[model samples]
Target: MADKKPEPATKNPKKANLLDHHSIKHILDETVSEIVSSRGYVEDVRLSNVRLLLGTVIIVIALFAQFYKKKFPENRDFLISCIVLYIVFNGLLQLIIYTKEKNAILFTYPPAGSFTSTGLEVSSKLPRFSDIYTLTIASADPKSISANPPVELTKSVTKWFTKDGVLVEGIFWKDVEALVDEYSKEPKKRK
Candidate 1:
């Protein structure tokens, strides 16, 4: 058999290229917000699935009661009692959930990760893999600064160059070295 020519992969026509012009921070913020919001959406879907399954089972049992009436005379009373109980119980649960909607939260899935240390607590809002990019931190060489002693050793200066080529000096107390290290390894992270 002859090998067929590989088809050109179709790109999404509707996908927006608007984000290309935006900064990394803007993209990171949007990604973080989407990830956080999806938690509630996921829980809503889970609860909806459970509600559907229970409703289906209840309907199936009701049909079974009707069809087996002739063969199961002794079980008729039991089935009827079960039907009443099921209706009442399910109805009560629905009423309670519906009425308490304002007071109670619809979903309560636990947070993925949380940490508290001393008086201040910390949480990581790391960006998705696709957002990874090389961020350059250009610090003035100590030797160069020493030769040109206008700037003291203790008060050293650094320049930050973002992936988007926008250069900003004195982006204070920035962890660019650590961020560069993270950017290299983060995309390859398994979990």
Candidate 2:
């Protein structure tokens, strides 16, 4: 008599490949959705920088305090655990800050989107992207109060126009330009 072997028991009745595909697809969809929905507009750069700096300090202090505590077994274990937790949780905090920076878009549309940022505001009732103009980057004039980048976006428009020339204390002009370019994209098929 031939020995009988039992068939493999599987929790999921579906094909193994299909289960793998489904889980991967679901995870990707959820991740993409979260990223897309997490749009942020950083109206204040200085405040964000300060908060980031504080987080950095906390992390640094946590790591530095370990030197004295490492001599004891229990204390060192506690410190190690705390530091690990801090690092793990800090990723979430950093993501929030990153999203804010990504969304720090000083808009240029109707209702005159102003972010309280020191940058050019189209004060006139002019249409956006109507004028095919050039960007003339003048030398940066830094303010003393700012600890971050002193880059500012001064509109290369004439004084006759309602172009508010501002010295953005913390807003980097490169970051602004990237957002502006993204926002200014025309739809493939206009509604």
Candidate 3:
């Protein structure tokens, strides 16, 4: 018999792309943007960028104030003002974000089998300030959408990036690919 060599295992392209921390964030951002836009919401990148910059600056100032407090005890009022400003700024931003059309019902999916549906609700006018994203998926019996009965479903999770943009230790690239694949599937036509 002739000697034969074994074939090397090939990595999935999607999974391979998701392996990097930066790419994972990028893909998730793109996917979420698509998902949100498909439901009729526009992504305000200018607002998003403004929120991110302001939030970052506030945090940096707070940290600097904290460090300064230890070195110069006489300047306690500066640290206090920075902390107060940070809190007040956040409260005002939240008030602005929730000012118009909050918790808008985006889409209602047709029943999977026969009796239930999964609806999506979104904070339609909120400016996204952080890296963390929240998607609300509600499942209820289709006939009783008025009653709004809740159905138990599996918890959704994602590989989170650190404050410094590094991926955390628990989630892997394959896991991310699996999540994206499952959610990206086409829906069945209703009869």
Candidate 4:
């Protein structure tokens, strides 16, 4: 029998485009403009910048007042009150501005699933593989897996195989548990 050459492994081998480049400056400019022009509450860069600057200045002044309070101990309460007032005012202003912007944005993009004041709908799609892998890797207990091969190998393989796999409902539950565990270690925030 005549020897025949083996067929090429892949019919269309995907080519890596290492030369693909995008202008960072252009992207940055576009992003900046988009954020600045955004109709959401926190979108107005000019207003936000001004408020932030004023708030910072007020905070510095308040600190200085506290430092000098030893000389005028009688006015300590007044200085403290002023500081509190400035902080409250700044926070309230920011909240109002952000709320307005958020309302505007939400109004522009109405919720597709349900009617809402913000007009935003919660997406029903499952989380991506990267998110799942991250949560899994972060939650992997050292005692659970044998310390033979590195955990990274297992994580990488899991991520690779599950990249396009259908995410079962249990996966979401696992992710939620992982998230809760992760956040439990952090400082509690006021609702």
Candidate 5:
């Protein structure tokens, strides 16, 4: 009797690759970050800096008054007033910024330098899924508090179903091209 050998198990299965979902999302995020960065859009660091400065100044003054209470009896009232004023000012600033940035285009998505899932969406299906990324780009003017609104552009890109465990399909250069073109255009500044 001739020896019989078992046939090799098939490597390809009908089930969808779940890893593709994460990979696709990651690639999309990286691409979006790169594009936004290329267009010179970056995180608004000045806002954080201003917040830090205000906090430091207020805390130092309060500490100084507390440490010298005996020498300055009036400082207790001064400290109380300072804290109340700071709270009011900080609250107002937060409200204003929040109100301005509450829109879908501004608050949810991360600036160019950060990574976040706010603008990325993945389909629920397992065997087949689509990855869609949406972003709005705008230049942050650090010089003026109320500088004219820089040009704003919203762009979205989608990758269709992943077939046969192979992640090869549409690159969507046209969508990206449109974004690049608009980004290259000179922003309008108010006189």
Candidate 6:
């Protein structure tokens, strides 16, 4: 009788390669979504800054009108009207600022020389995030950049954070990586 050998056992029986392909595709999709979402946060910071500045201007104008009315009591009604209009406009601006501040992400402007928040002085232009942290730490106080840093570096860092992850303040790249790993391990736990 001829010796018979058993057929080799298949390493995977459930079309694991296909499953793996699906898994890889899913991971890629999720990663891209997360990156896009985080970028929106950065954009929010820019918008918030603009809102804050405009709100401040409106408030200042309102205060000035109120003071003017108080000083010139001769034209009481006219002065009062100006004050009232300014107050209403200022109130609207404040409302917008409040909404943006609550919903928007915080961004650090880089250090140029030194600045005081209570004073709200921008020396020249805005700083990039990486340089901002470093310069702010080095400076006696936070300040604006003399000129806007090259956009290339800022864009690169933004892209890097989205793809590889970034260590922002206490938010570390390793921490993000661990979170992603945990989420991937148990998709149900995410919800």
> What is the C-alpha local distance difference test score of each model?
0.35, 0.35, 0.43, 0.34, 0.42, 0.34
Say which candidate scores most in TM-score: 5
Q: Which prediction has more favorable lDDT, 3 or 6? A: 3
Per-residue lDDT of model 2, residues 1-191, tens digit only: 02222222324321112223333223222322222122332222454566677688667757765565446665776777667767765776677657533323222112125322233111111124332112221111124221123223333223211223222212223333433334323325567
Could you tell me how far off, in angstroms, the CA of residue 167 lies in candidate 4 after the best superposition?
20
TM-score of each: 0.29, 0.29, 0.33, 0.28, 0.37, 0.30
> What TM-score quantifies how close candidate 3 is to the native fold?
0.33
lDDT of 5 by residue, 1-191 (tens): 02222222335422334446655544444444444444344434454466567667667656765676455565667767767876775775676456534322221233245332122111111122543444444333324333223333332223432454432222433344355445334457699
Candidate 6: stretches off by over 4 Å: 1-46, 66-70, 98-100, 107-173, 177-191
Residue pairs with backbone atoms closer than 3 Å in model 3 (clashes) = none
For candidate 2, which ten residues in a row score worst on lDDT? 132-141
Count: clashes, candidate 2: 2
User: How many clashes in candidate 1?
Assistant: 0
State which candidate, 4 or 5, has the greater lDDT.
Answer: 5
lDDT of 3 by residue, 1-191 (tens): 02222222324223313334345545444444444443333333444455577688778877877777355678777878888888887876676457522443233343234232343332212123332434433332235443242221122224444444443423433333334334434445599
Best by lDDT: 3
Q: Report how far residue 31 has shifted in candidate 3, in Å.
A: 5.1
Of models 2 and 4, which has the larger lDDT? 2
Report the lDDT tens digits of candidate 4 across residue range 5-89.
2322434332222222122222222222232223121222444466677678777767777676356668777777777877776
Summarize candidate 1's per-residue lDDT along 64-146 as a digit string, tens digits.
77776556667878688778867975785586456533222223232234121111001122134343332221111214321
Candidate 3 weakest lDDT stretch, 10 residues: 1-10
lDDT of 4 at 48: 47
The TM-score measured for candidate 2 stands at 0.29
Evaluated at residue 41, the lDDT of candidate 1 is: 21
| Model 3 error, position 105 (Å) | 12
Pairs of residues at least 3 apart in sequence or in different chains that clash in candidate 6: none
